[model samples]
Target: MKLIKGTLVALTCAAMLMGCESKKKETSSIDVKDAEVSKNLVLDLSVDKVKNTLGTLKEADSFPRNITKGQKDWNLVGVRDWCSGFWPGVLWYAYELSDDPEIKAGAEKFTAPLKEIAYTPADNHDVGFMVYCSYGNGYRLTGNEEYKTVMLAAADTLATLYNPKVGTILSWPVMVDKIGYNTIIDNMMNLELLFWAAKNGGDKSLYDIADSHAQKSMEHLVRPDYSIYHVALFDEKTGEFTKGITHQGYADESMWARGQGWGIYGFALSYRETGKEEYLDTSIKLADHFIERLPEDGVPYWDFDDPKIPNAPKDASAASLVACGMLELADQVKDNALKVKYTQAAKDLMAKLESKAYFSGDTNQALLLHSTGHLPHNSEIDVPIIYADYYFMEALVRLKKLEDKIAMQ
Candidate 1:
């Protein structure tokens, strides 16, 4: 029943791509707002920082992971790292913005090391994170057949982790707990690669796999209030849902801000691929939930439902991801009021990201600062993560397109 077939599905995808392409074209008649002008200034600064970072990394043989505060050096890691693709992805975004030859070359060079991981990913279900972000962006921006082939192989590898019975991709092969089938809300972001492959050149079963995972996540991981749990455990043999717990949140019951961000982006992307009304509705709910919990500056505490609220660490990555999803959701909705509400919210979030509180000053190598990776382990509590930078740049790219689209209208 999940199977969507033949020319109709293909044509629908084509129309969506065409609409996206049309929005990228610039228009001179549309007046740019003063707030947007300020946003543009921040984006330009970000691009320069990226260029300088890449320039410094040109001598390195590997990709950057993250930087500690007041550190001039970037920590290096192999392609096996979950965050490997983000640097290349950020480079690709820079090229899309400036079309600089050096930036394009850097993007390709950094992507070269990741090609092997597409075929030989570890048992974790993050090939989407490792391959899709790098080569996926490569294929989208450059139309390189090589990138497409690598990404399709990665999609196949990711599919192998899919538990049809459990209806979600396995996030980690081994966890501290002995659960045979473990899934996370972060897995939702991985489905975009599957949907892309299915619509473009891969099997329709890919779409079904992604859809099933989304359906299951909605059933078990999302709370009635729209906050998401970090992890959902299931019996591998029977697909019976067991328990919902938090591996990275403040507590088992707390609302992890980044988990909600993942849900928002994942569901908005699902709506985009399938035109499913339910997906859009759920995305809106998740976005609203996150927005309602934001502090006055719009950046969220690491966990929305945490006890140390006012003193909690800020997660700029969550804000960046939510902003990107909200912009996409704003475009897809038919209700003008909803569209405006989401659009302004996205702009506010972006503005907060550019502010002195969250924005790492010009001296830092990282673009956005104060991201929380794993709070429970006392690891990466407050730092600049590569994924945070990648999403922030991506949100800027999306905001520009939305601005151009609105101007034309």
Candidate 2:
């Protein structure tokens, strides 16, 4: 469980990247709050909400997924569920914020069942979601060797889905027959696992695989306007990109808010890992588009192109994810204007997320409300999703660190 000094330094550097102070220039129209109360209050409230939800789970196998309309309880799922990691991740973040033993115990309990996922090669690309968010954060915070072993195995299992010819990991094996080769914007979030593995005694090629995937995604999934396609199809045999499409968006051409959030966060993290200018550029472009498209409150509708407009369901999840991504992007960008812009955009988004309009409060156990999962399928519409809460807490933690860094300076 003991980390060498090098690994500790790497971890510290990563945290510093997420927590770096923005330039003092006030370029944003949005007023950035300076009070410590605003920062700590939201985080404190989130810890209480997550701890309360943890008390409600009676079954060892159950993990909170979402709360349906008019439903009082979380729709629980098993360890195999893609979202299962977020609840444990939420627990880890809560523990990080409070250093509370009860939350740590709950985090370990929820995270333990997911270790099985590492040993098994997944039929889909979401083993990163199932393992990395749980064991990855666990290992990051606690330096647990068992967690590290699970993450390395999970990363190797995830690597099995990579197609050398296609230059990206296959996102959904179930859809390969129908879609040729499929990669989604969400898969970008999984590359951190491979990058971490490559650095931590796994094959060096794991880094190459992740780097190649990010490059291919940039070439195929990102549009001229820097908006993203939810899915990109390629020839499995020939490794040629066939088409761009959508599975969850309002249309193939419309920007799905959450998918765009994934691109921003994914590319930002990729740039963080590889120090590639192109990746950083892509993240900044996507972020600019997202910021320009947001409503006055800073949260976005489920789809920018959704005909409903003001009537379209607001995706607090998208806002949460983008807020976290923007914080990362803020740290990576050298331009002081961009740094302030992204940092303020993140702050505004978090402000809206913490407001009475978005925060779940006593209305539910989930941290944020009104996340649209897959509207085309009429599923999880305007519900409280676990990943929203996970990223919301993550953004808070990052923002808090930024504040602390500024204070120390």
In angstroms, how far off is 137's CA in candidate 1?
0.9
Q: Write the per-residue lDDT of candidate 1 for residues 1-409, one digit (tens) a residue.
A: 0111232344345445555667663321011112233325566656666877898885333788778777866777777788889999999998887677888899999998888877884578788988889999999999999999988888888998887778888898877266557899999999998999898888889999999998899889998989898899899889999889988898878899889989988998888888888888999999988888788867888998778878889898888888888888887889999999998988898877777667764447887879998888988878888889999999888887877777999
Query: How high is the lDDT of residue 381 in model 1?
Result: 75
* C-alpha lDDT values of all predictions: 0.82, 0.86
Model 1's C-alpha root-mean-square deviation from the true structure amounts to 11.2
Using lDDT, give the best candidate's number.
Answer: 2
Model 2, range 1-409, lDDT digits (tens) per residue?
1112333344344444434554443211111122222335456656766787889897767899999888777999998888989989999998887788888999999999998888987888899888888888889899999899889999999999999999999999988767678999999999999999999988999999999999999999999998999999998889899999999999999999999999999999999999999999999999999988888767899999999888899999999999999999999999999999999999989888877678776676778889999999999999999999999989988987898899999
Off by over 4 Å in 1: 1-39, 59-61
My TM-score estimates for the predictions, one after another, are 0.89, 0.90
